[model samples]
Target: MIDPQPDGHLPVAAEKRTADGTAPDLEHGRMINGGENLWMTEIQSVLAQSGTKKTTAYLSHECRMERLPHSETYLGGGREIFQKEKPWEFLTYTQEGRIYQFGNPAVMTVPPSSEGDGTFPPAFEIKGCNSQAHCPDRQIYYFDYDEIHERLLSNQISVRSLFLQVSWSTGGDDWTLYSPCRYVNFSNPAFQTSSYIQPIAGTVLMPVGDSFVPGSIACSLNDKGDHIIEASSRVFRDMAEWRIRQEQPPEVARKSIRDVQQVMPTFFLSQDHIIPINGTVRLYRYL
Candidate 1:
């Protein structure tokens, strides 16, 4: 876990050295608890110190966006932003002596290649979880490892669970919010059992609308602790693809899924065929 320094500056973890003074191995892997880059450290720190309104203000000014809650911004806007390069590269060590490098640039800029041992995949996004009930989004973050314990003791049921959520975009025209398609959860091993799982730990992959569907592939586990992947029903493929494209630009995501509509069959199941004169029936449909 990241500890605050006496001077209030987050101390970046020093690189690990072998007995021969050589660097350790670098590979992109799953998420780690309290493992965030300097930029994330800054963002998390600001969010922790500032209240909801103040945190929103800080984020707006830093990202150069309007002072509106839930607005989005790119890193170093313009050509550099389009590149989506990661900045501030360095190595961090887990308590188990494992070293990991950062790879995603959207969360931070890519540092000079020579400076660090290797890069792990970048986090998809690092922002507050703003919603209708949680507008300012300050309560959406939980940095302390014991946060859950405290919440459980206090019966704070409305607190957010995941530490970070990375929403990846699918090939679509409409602007949609997507949870990160790729991530690792160190705290919860149960969630790691399946690829189609949602956020159950400090980091999670959530859909814009907080829903999930099976993809074109089926995942089953064997006795040897290996995941067996195979082709699945066409219906599964179409559903997963459509859910993914929710991250696309508004125009593209708004485009019709004509292929899926033509190939897949639709069904409507209701508890009753007729509505009662004085009773109301609620109908809900997922897009």
Candidate 2:
């Protein structure tokens, strides 16, 4: 497992730049495993000799942080977090199984200036077919690409079967491939022809429901066809609070339950199985 340090330190050395501030020649930015020490040494030397301005200029102008797969696994690996130019987080909205991005050709065209005026136009053109028909059911979705990177690199769970490639006719000449909701109903003919596929870098999974609760359960199957039930910790902790409610007053119990519900650290998935160890740990299937 590539257990990258959480300090956000670059394990590999920042590449040496030319005197004219161009990037050093490289076929690709890939670095072999166990070669990080040598790279670190080179980077430290450059930083000490060149100081902050040179180092910043080189990284900003030539190098960019990107997530790369490990030598052994195709899933995920260490990633460097960079400060984004915009304050807003990148998000995508989906309408009628089609994705709409902000100010991009796939959705909207470039903003137009008011004719001969310095001010920009009130609105820009929306691209794509059936624009009016596809606007109503649009839902804002968040796909946690960073968390997927962490999960795959950490080897905590199998991500292979968490996604399925969906083939759908957009009423056009060609078909499109999309990753459906994990809890998508397979029996639905509209969502038929979804096959298991490996997720790529920056793959995002949005929640699978009309409304979301604090500890909603999302279900999916693994590559082995084992049902996986994922839920936030708040679900069980709230039950724990409910179990201990008799010892406290009504208001106190209510407060405790609410407190437990508010502190879910993360969502986790487990397979359906009963461990044959000293004690049984039964993981029930959600579906």
Best by TM-score: 2
Q: Give candidate 1 regions above 4 Å deviation.
A: 1-141, 153-164, 167-264, 267-287
lDDT tens readout by residue for model 2, 96-194: 323233221122222221112111111222244221111111111222333333444444333322332221221221221222233332222246543
- Candidate 2 global CA lDDT score: 0.25
lDDT of 1 at 110: 32
For each candidate, how many residue pairs have backbone atoms clashing (under 3 Å)? 31, 0
TM-score of each: 0.17, 0.18
Q: Which segments of candidate 2 are over 4 A away from where they belong?
A: 1-90, 96-207, 211-249, 253-287
